[model samples]
Target: MKRPSAWHLVLAPLALLFALPLLWLLVSSVMTNAEINRFPPALIPSGIDLGGYRYVLGNALFPRWFVNSMIVSAVAVTANLAFGTLGGYAFARIRFAGSKLMLGMMLATMVIPFQLTMIPTFLVMKSLGLIDTLGALIIPSLVTPLAVFLFRQFFVSLPRELEEAAWIDGCGRLRILVSIVLPLARPALSTVAVLTFLSTWNDLTWPLIAINSDSNYTLQLGLTTFQGQHHTQWAAVMAGNVITVLPVLLGFLLAQKAFIRSLASTGLKG
Candidate 1:
């Protein structure tokens, strides 16, 4: 038998460290209030309690909030993919006036804190009559600089010969992008999609500031109701958070291989 690798000793501890919070969340969701409030905090519950799940699921508005989150995430992901892909491809291949300046400007915006732009974004959404609506959330996130940058990096590494050959065959630039470029960019596409979905689904701050109507609240925003000035429902909040994150967690797990592959490929080549 082969001797154990030394890396296992280091990795095992690190893995547990990262997993601790999520493990705590899962276990605490099923623990009684008395059990959870114990001084040391219970890692294992003596008995399971469904009180949290019941509390959250019993609320009629929960379903509406879930649907609202789904709509916003779906639209944001689709819009980012469509627009980011095009913009990235242009930055990667097409030579246009001030293209480098534009790319630099776009990348620069990514460094600026979102907190600085929130008020201006809210005002813009209000002027467009999108405030207090799902559109308010969707419109601002339709495309992001990170998404565009990822696509551009991935596209830049693609072989010019393939695009040239397509051009020789009289294929239009758009057609070439659709047929030749995108097929090979599956890994990047998957990465962008998963990232976009995760961001949009988990976003609460902007939605909170923009949407006053409870009916328009996203899942993350709706989960906040479990807490109030006097009473805080820890169990329900924990359970609601679990439900809120479940889809994003599952999507990441399923797409993790592709996601990692995309980033690695992008980093190495382009």
Candidate 2:
């Protein structure tokens, strides 16, 4: 059997260091509030206490928040994948006047921080009467420059011969894209889907600004209500966080292979 290298020895502890918090969170979620607040926190609980999870799940507002987050995330992922893939395919395969210039302008927007555009986005949402609605959260994040860039790069790396062959078969551009190109672009599509889902699922800042009504709050925004000025519910907060993180973790685990493959292939081509 081959022996482990020095690099593994160096990295193992670092990996564990980063994993400790997640481990702690999982452990702490089952702990009592009293156990959590003890002078020296218990690494392991005396007994499993599921009160936090029970409370969160039983709460009337939590289910609504969960549903809202799911709706927004689903819409965001669908919109980003559909639009980003189309825009990316166009930039990769189609040649038009000022295409390069337009692509450059789109890429440049990525460098502009979200904070700079937040006010303008909020105002626009207000003007459209989307404020305090799920639309406020979903509209602004439907697609991103990064998703477009990833799709374009992956599309560029594909052989032109395949597309040309489809064209020779009398396939129109949209037909070629949907029938030939997208079927082979699974990795890129998976990467975009996973990324869009994660971003929309975890987004808190924009929702905070755009949504005022408690009923419309996303999971992240709803979780904030657990923290009070005088006392915070650590167990409930941790339980809520675990619930919030599970979907993203499960999503990545399912799509991680394609995500990595797409990123590696995109980077190599670039």
Best by TM-score: 2
Error of 1 at 155 (Å): 1.6
Per-residue error for 196 in candidate 2, Å, reads 1.3
Model 1: colliding residue pairs: none
Per-residue C-alpha lDDT of model 2 across residues 1-270, encoded as one tens digit per residue: 988798988899999999999988888888889987888988789998998898888887887899999999999999999999899999999999999998999999988998999999999999999999999998888889888999998899999998897798888888998998999988788888876787799988999999998899899899887545114567877888789888987776777787576557647845
Q: How close is candidate 2 to the true structure, as a TM-score?
A: 0.90
Locate the minimum summed-lDDT window of 10 residues in model 2: 225-234
Tell me the TM-score of each prediction against the true structure: 0.85, 0.90
Q: Following a full C-alpha superposition, what root-mean-square deviation does model 1 have from the true structure?
A: 3.0
- Candidate 1 per-residue C-alpha lDDT over 87-165 given as tens digits, one digit per residue, 9 for 90 to 100: 9999999999999999999999987998999999999999999899999998889999989999998898888998998
lDDT of each: 0.87, 0.86
Cα-based lDDT at residue 115, candidate 1: 97
Q: How large is the C-alpha RMSD of every model relative to the true structure?
A: 3.0, 2.4
